[model samples]
Target: MTVTSAPETYPETYSAGAYWGARKESPEDCARRTAGFLNLLAECDPFLSHWYTPARSRRDARKHPLMPPDVATLAELFRRGMNREPGGPAIEELGFRFSFDNGGATGDCATLRINGGMSSEAVPNHCVLNVPWRGPNADRLLTAAVLTKAVRAMVLSWEPDWALAGSSAYKMQYPEPDSAPFSLGWITYLSRRIGTVPPLPAPVRIEPVEDRGTLIILTPERFTVANPEHVALARRVRELLVQAGLMQ
Candidate 1:
């Protein structure tokens, strides 16, 4: 296979691995560090302002059992880690690797890869999260959450009777887009929902297909379409963004 190397001109953004490498501190310390980083991000990049909203409360968090508190902590860490150098904690602990790679002749830019998975091809310009799960109620709930977050675009792929264990199942794929920062946020957010937080590998491979394109390879279990509710949830998320003025 003709391996097309990554491109150049990507921008440097923080990654979970980078945060892990910074230092080791108590969870509270980490929280403070994260909050600081987010504040700094707001000052530097105007686009990230949308993500600066108040964090979900513990009760609210419990409602989404799949979402771990660490995800929120990591998000905060990203906000702070970017503002200052790696200190107070190690980036490795945070579960991300932030590096810059060229997207071939495109330009020199940064790419964020997970768990040494296919190196981040390039900062995504846009991102769409598709949740395919069984049952209409759960799917609607997930869709409501996605919409509340104001995702720009989304795809909800649904399948019924996925588990085959006399029950339904669901999966989601957040397609990469051109919106770099927002795309990262979307990944972080969805991962938390699926109980796949940072420091976890992408569970798939992103291989360069041809030109500047890529093909994501997923296992059978992960690819199965078992749930329709999640798919519907993703659709509502797209609508929510339009109503919130976050998407075009």
Candidate 2:
């Protein structure tokens, strides 16, 4: 995919504190949980093994923008997993080894390490999806759906709560001047792709307080669904987990 530059008129309103505070999952926790979630996805979908990797780039590291600390940590974890090292005690049961890297870009880069190379010709999933708002918003949404569908088809079939990070509406509160508009576009795109628009909570109001923005947290809905065709597969997996008594 071609990388698009950020808009010249992109507003600058991102506040690090506001964005972090609004997150239900801390960055570290999100990395670990995402790894595990993706592992579950791998069991259900065949495309996952094609999209993950454990390679690292030490050359010209300084040329790339500073990677998000969390992303970097996760990338390191994946590298370790590839070498068959313990790699942080398997934070979750899904056997997911995920880490992120900065790569000096606004969008985060992620790496997933898989054991015993599943496919001979499969390349690593190294593409980073940025969230800038310049392209046709619909295209942005379609791209997000492709990513999500790939994730669901290859990793886990479950959905998680998502928030729009860089919209003008959100920037009014947590002004992340460098944040990508990809996530926001993903939500809009995915809603249409699934052919079902889940009811969204009312937009939260942001009040300015002491030169900082205060967020009014809104309840988010779950995006999980079960279709009849997958009923047997889901039931079998549930039964195996129950028999193993591995509920955590």
Candidate 3:
């Protein structure tokens, strides 16, 4: 008798992010990084090209175009977004927080959230990109290849300790270890500050992200937790990474 395999389940949404421990920076510094990141992201995909500052209304949002990012404008936006205590003054330790998005239909759009300029070693500064579940371009843009570019863009622009791109479900299944620089994903970027990436078994490819560090591609196709093969491979790779001192 012939049997049919169960359908695979995948997360409805995916996200990419870069993270690093506290590093003190000014609004200008954060703006510079933000501008550079957006430019890199635009080159990664057409869907990621346009962005707008968050505002009370769509009309107001369009008044400020985040793309072709103006360093001066971004610096002003970051300054306005500074963490303040009630009505007292800007809290230096809390850092600057800002969010923007590529305006479009629900599924077609994406949000970029940023938190930087912190001085506390305990807090992590990050740039996160969130993509929706379904959309007109979803079929084409949501592939492992595109997501890998997104992660690479983040790594190149931020030069964070680590960066990752994949479904939220996969990340939930394999949360990042406190001592590890980053969690595995469809594409994971590790800074040299973390350590060298050791070789792994087949289908897993590793490439350099300039002089920054390495990019590990788990699979050329979609990686889903529902697939035992995918999960097993990720676990195995994680084990090897830890053994190689890339993770703890």
Off by over 4 Å in 3: 1-11
Q: After superposing candidate 1, which stretches have Cα over 4 Å from the reference?
A: 1-176, 180-225
Instruction: Return the clash pairs for model 3, or none.
Output: none
Residue-level lDDT of model 1, residues 45-70, one tens digit each, is 23222231222453443333211124
Quality of model 1 by C-alpha lDDT: 0.27
Highest lDDT scorer: 3
Error of 3 at 166 (Å): 0.7
lDDT of 2 by residue, 115-202 (tens): 2211222222221222222334323322332344433322221121222222233324323234321132112222111122223324
The candidate 2 region of ten consecutive residues with least summed lDDT is 13-22
Per-model lDDT: 0.27, 0.29, 0.85
Listed in order, each prediction's TM-score against the native is: 0.21, 0.24, 0.91
Candidate 3: Cα lDDT at 168: 84
Cα lDDT tens digits, model 3, 1-248, are 99999999654577889998888899999999888888888887888898998988878888887879998999988889888989799889878999988877766778999999988777689999988668666776778888888888888777799898887887886787676667888788888898999988989999998899899998888777878899999999999998998776
TM-score of 1: 0.21
lDDT of 3 at 129: 95
For model 1, the run of ten residues with the poorest summed lDDT: 157-166
